[model samples]
Target: MSHPHLHQPRCLAGIVIYRPEFEALRGLVVSLSGDVATVAIYANSPISGEQQQALRKAASPAKLVILRPGLNRGLGAAYNALHQLAQADGNAFLLLLDQDSAPRPGMAGALMATYRRLAERGERPAAIGPQPVDLAGEKMQLPAAARQNGEKPLRASFVISSGSLIHLDAMAAIGGFRTDYFIDAIDIEWCLRAGAAGYSIWVDPTVPMPHRLGQGVIRLPLGLLLTDQPPRRLYTYVRNQLAMLRLQHVPVRHKAKFLLSLPVRLAVHLVHHRFSADCTVALVNGLRDGVLVRLGPPDRALIPFWRQGWRSRATTPRNTAAVPAALRQS
Candidate 1:
């Protein structure tokens, strides 16, 4: 695996993983880059031969290179690792993707257009992402926001890492991702810092990036139907959200609503998932930690095995006492 030097442009759109759905993934890359002249940052598995052959066929016009990490680092680490690789290639735009996600029609182009337009207008709105729609091409229920004018940049309450685009300049200004976060709310925390620093964040509603809502491995066939809520997700959701609530700038109402809504969401998760031991554990963990930490990142060890950086962090007084010993060790 060749590691390119870091001081280059970020024109590459990277797919982060060890295991891959190269056919599905390379298909998206081919569609977006129009050339496989792209790179795969593999923390564990190399791109497979079948996937490779498919990539070769579909990835023509696009360029593809695979970089094998010395070990299986987590998603944030993979991205920080990929960040340099993308810049090394002299590409101007860096797109973040999960193995299962892809950009819809205008997503790639429109987001690029928005970024350029924002920059030309002299805006430094920290980070931006596509308005995510759920699978089956439906829009997720998103909070409504009135369009704001001017350069303070719009403050974003929530941002997803997958399909997220960050300005390299912003990274330079704020320093690279807070790697110490290692697990949850990474994107939200970073955006919060930028918002705090007066950088605006806006979602280009025109870009329709689709996300696979967490219904789980068993119910994936539901294709938006409910089954088991991913246990690990529940864990991170609880712990890290609490951490964010601690941040002073977060809207008081948002925090209060979230706190109040916890039980209802958990009940829904429990009913849908049958409150299996994992779900129950996750429910307990989520509420306990969300309150104490405000739903930010988890102890580095508890990170569920997964992919992508467009995801952890928070501002809270240390509560080494509040963390569950098991999660702390994981």
Candidate 2:
């Protein structure tokens, strides 16, 4: 494996696949092939043999390995699997991406440059995440504090798993992603653990990755906010946030703030037209489950509500190109 940047050859890119369209997967593989030494695909669900072949063929000039866990192990397990693989393969860093996110051209180089600069400044970062821009090119109207200020890399509470460049040693030191978390808040939990151990997480402003945050985002006077998720996902979000409350590594003030905001968030769900009666039920159930520390798959009864809009944005064929021409130029 050879690349222009020093870290390109040493970094391994990993994507967790769950019902992603073949074209989208291929586009992502192809984009990663441009600079990544290896692209490890963790297939959490079954894909046809023909589709697997197409993925391999599309990842030309870059090594691709498909790791089929045989069942859906969820995001945290998939990420942990990739982290261990990267560590064993002697890669210095592992770049994690969700199936929906597409890396901007030259993102790896930009991230590595920031990593090196941070190290030079004596700030040892456990993970470095790029600012995520919505795929639709919506001006990220997040609150100034959430968006942060300054042109330089900024310290973050935690970065989303997608487009995060994590040091293998740092991952090992903090222990890997909590597999029990299943999906939501896994990144923040890992980051909090790292922070507790004196490691930091930073976000590079120069490198922006195209990501679709939720089912959709709505721009409001407050900021750009994610629309209410369908029932099951809402359950996970609530459950995971509550679970974080039980973690010793999580900062107390952060917990206090999140606790206070719970009512406002629930009130939005109650009033929002997007959320259904099922969402309210899931919310109540999730609160109970979170209090009891019961974690795993959601209640079987709620499965019916998981039907639409989970990954609708990413699964569309029209958006398959992981690195669009405009993104490359930017």
Candidate 3:
């Protein structure tokens, strides 16, 4: 893939960090040194003064800005904050990254090139993203449109947040990310809304970024591999997916696909977690809240259950908060 021409608009890269592995975080910052004008490290978790200094040093020649919320504000909130920062700084594009992703050298440039090419052809591309290749060599299934041949950017319904280069102007027109839905499915919700608003989403398959989805891959019969996630993740995933189904902007086919697969997904999660009490409760409550349209951070009622079941096994607490008063009363 070719590098974006120097004449292209400036790009700002925003990386959302939780409790990250320092080495990986440093590597990611170093990799983007010459590619982006500035690197914004948004700390969803608190960062020590020493760690902040270390992060700044990793950004090297590129300007570095730290957005320390000092608490877990969810992925959508972080992205929204990054978008505001980019707009204030007069950047034309915002590149989103998660700490788990390690983009290849020219990945950002390749995405930029695709965005520019699309723009020149009178296409309004809201965002352009690279294909996410699993680090463990698991084959992630792609949409039918994305499987087409050649280097041309393929139209996609949605792309993952990590490794996506978003056009700031388009984002302003589409509105900010949905902080209500919080973390899971934020990217899908935004991308679907963009399409509904007449902006296109593209994926440049030529640019592959090493990304990990969930905890790991669970090998199944007939070569199928399901992403293995914790029970809390399962709860958010189900709730958010169901929330999207209620949105007018989300395509009907997408909703139908999810509905069809919901049972199998729940069964898989149950078996994978050995039908543990916490896992069962998470799935049931997620379904109930989703149907009731109770959306926001994880439900507060479920937090202690998870804490007792698996909190000690995790590095960071699964951030939880009470639902809105209105929703709770309902």
Candidate 4:
């Protein structure tokens, strides 16, 4: 975690946690200790007594600043909270992580070094991220743009939320993450807006971070895809992606890509999953909401949809569950 070139003093590290395993969270925080000036954990889920004690004990050595707002504010809102904290503390960069990501040695240093090199070469990058080495899936998805950058770091459309070292001023200029997105596609939307504001997004393959996408993935003839997420998440993914389709800032190619790929994905989910009917209903509802520009958290109208899915699963004979643990909503 030692950063030899720690000249730029204001690098803050933060993670957004929901219901997480105590040991895993502790390991992640310990990994960040020597690399960052300050570490903040924004817990958006209710913590059990034992879990809280374990987190406190883990933080004692690292001296973490943990903030729990007493409710699940979703990913983008929690990220916005971190952005405000970074801004107020006058930090130059914010290293964002998911609760599960386990940083390897020099992970932060690699990102920071790449940022400095890119800046020296006259590239104003909005953020730089490390290559994600999935713990469960063991697969990595790099943007096509990654292959063209040669020796330098690859310029990409958007990086994953975790293992991303974001430039604070650039994010401030682009108005930060959109809370309306709530969960899915928040990073993509922010990247699109940043690009529209003339900022680049780069990925340094040399710095690989151990991350997990879903709890696990399924092998299909087409490819390896994430297991069936919860119906509510499926709805959010559809709605947010469609919402992106309406934005001018989002690249047309990305919009077209989504238009083509999302249906195939939906078909796959409907085919292999036990909750096919629920997924279909969720997709339809999502499409309707997306078309109407209904943004923000799922309101009371959507609660029945979730309840219906749960009831249907409960009544089933075998009770096959599709949602993965890592992808479960808190």
Candidate 5:
């Protein structure tokens, strides 16, 4: 299964960094340098000059460009910026990577080969991604419809943002990632939109990338595995899923499934957090803002309350409704 274009530098790799582990980021950059034309590091968190120099050194031979926005602009914004960079640089494809993902050396090549095969058969593929394997060596499960039948790429409903190789033209036609989504569900929303736009999403099951979803997995009875996400992440997870349900382009079946599981998900979070007041407030406010279509950054008033070690007796407003209408509007 040799791809003649395996070493071709037609792709631009974009890695989004947010308080990432230094060695992990450096390793990722090194792994991708030889395969892609250029490696672009989008710093969602501030990076010191010393770290920048070290990263540039790690990305040797391949050009490295660091995009420092000087603020946390969310995953979608970073991807959108990377997409623009890909277009401007005239690269054929864009490879999106999160800081935590550890892609195998030839992952990008495998994805591109699959994309080519699909195109040869007249299938319009918007993007192709590698199958993700968690640290425990367990492969992420795909829906039955998405399973690979033969040599063809798996027809996934959506693939995670990390390890995904997106065709520049297809991305242009579908429009870039949604900045409003901020951090969560950015990939799912984009894939759904791509499907609606008559383009297919594929997964190269033969290619596996090491990726972790949240803090870790919480194994409960009956073999249920819930990702252990922080309260802030929990807020966006609930909020974005609810927001997606309102979009017409999002599939009806997906929305139905989410609605059925929403309550259970909330219950699990409550128990996981040990009924912490911060978790309760985040969940409640997520629901309220999601229903009200307050789609932007997280509500300002709730920020301090959800952070680590904030006293519950501090008496902060629990929901956006409690914030002044003027402040909420802001």
Candidate 6:
């Protein structure tokens, strides 16, 4: 394996998130620093002031940014901001990550190097993700990892943003993440779009990155459900999937299957996990919102949207901590 910028030295932009644990942030910083040529992070605050400051200290190279409430922008927005920041700072590549996920030693370098190789060969790889390993450094069972050996191109629409190396040029071609969709499926949406536009999304299985499975599995009679994600997550998942489906305007057959299948999947969860009122409410709201929003799938909703216009904007984040005033948008 060759180091693309062994001498060139390009800045690597990392998005170190501010989740609950201080030690987790510290570990991620250490992991990223080991492999990246140069790292600058846009730290998000979902923790206390004391914890945020401690995280800043741990992520020495990172400059913590205040995340505003009412906005609680999704990962896509954070990633897009990091890309813009990196561009301003003269970075060659963007390394997107969550606090729970950290690149293995040498993975970052290999990713960057691979991108350079593809560029040199005139093969435009939109994004490259390393095979994810669990916190214990074991490869988490992916739905289809058994078939992939070493670095391989993903034929379908599965790409992990947590450890992916994105090309600045390719990103410029297609505008950044769709902020409207909120959380789930944003990365897949981008990767799928890139693939449709003749760019390849690759996964270097050998370049291992450790990521904690944030969404825990719900063991149930029917089937295991990913119950760790919150009700709000459920809301975003519904809205985003609908938004993505609308935006892509995929084939009717595919759309029908998805529409039909999603409810069944949710029903399975509803029965198995003993669905909370919030979950059921989300299911109803999601269905209603998805059906009523006839603005065509092509309509990209604004990044910072309020469910009930200006009145609902004041609600606090249920799971995360309050954000600093500076980062908040008025």
lDDT for 221 (candidate 3): 83
Report clash pairs, candidate 4.
Answer: none
Full-model lDDT for every candidate: 0.57, 0.73, 0.78, 0.73, 0.78, 0.60
- The sequence of per-residue lDDT tens digits that candidate 6 reaches over residues 2-24 is 44444544646465465446676
lDDT of 4 by residue, 1-330 (tens): 534425555777888988788788878876776666667888777666676566556644334566667667577777877777777777888999998688875577678889989999999999998877777535377665545645568889899889899989887787767777677888888887888999999988777788876655566765656555666777888878887777788888999988988777787767766556666777766776665666678652244445534222111111011211232212
Give per-residue lDDT, candidate 6, residue 284.
57
Off by over 4 Å in 4: 1-6, 47-63, 136-139, 145-151, 222-227, 300-330
- Superposition error at 210 for model 6 (Å): 2.2
Report model 5's TM-score to 2 decimal places: 0.87
Considering lDDT, which of the candidate structures 3 and 4 is the better prediction for this target? 3
Error of 5 at 46 (Å): 2.6
Q: Report the Cα lDDT for candidate 3.
A: 0.78
Work out how many backbone clashes candidate 6 has.
2
Worst ten-residue run, lDDT, model 1?
321-330
TM-score of 4: 0.84
Global Cα lDDT for candidate 5: 0.78
Q: Which is better, 1 or 5, measured by lDDT?
A: 5
Report clash pairs, candidate 2: none
Q: In candidate 1, residue 306 scores what lDDT?
A: 38
Q: Candidate 2 lDDT, tens digit per residue, 116-193?
A: 889899987999988888877643432222557777888887888899999887777777776655778888788888
Residue lDDT tens for model 1, 167-190 = 666655654554434455667666
Report per-prediction Cα RMSD to one decimal: 9.0, 9.3, 7.3, 8.4, 7.5, 7.3
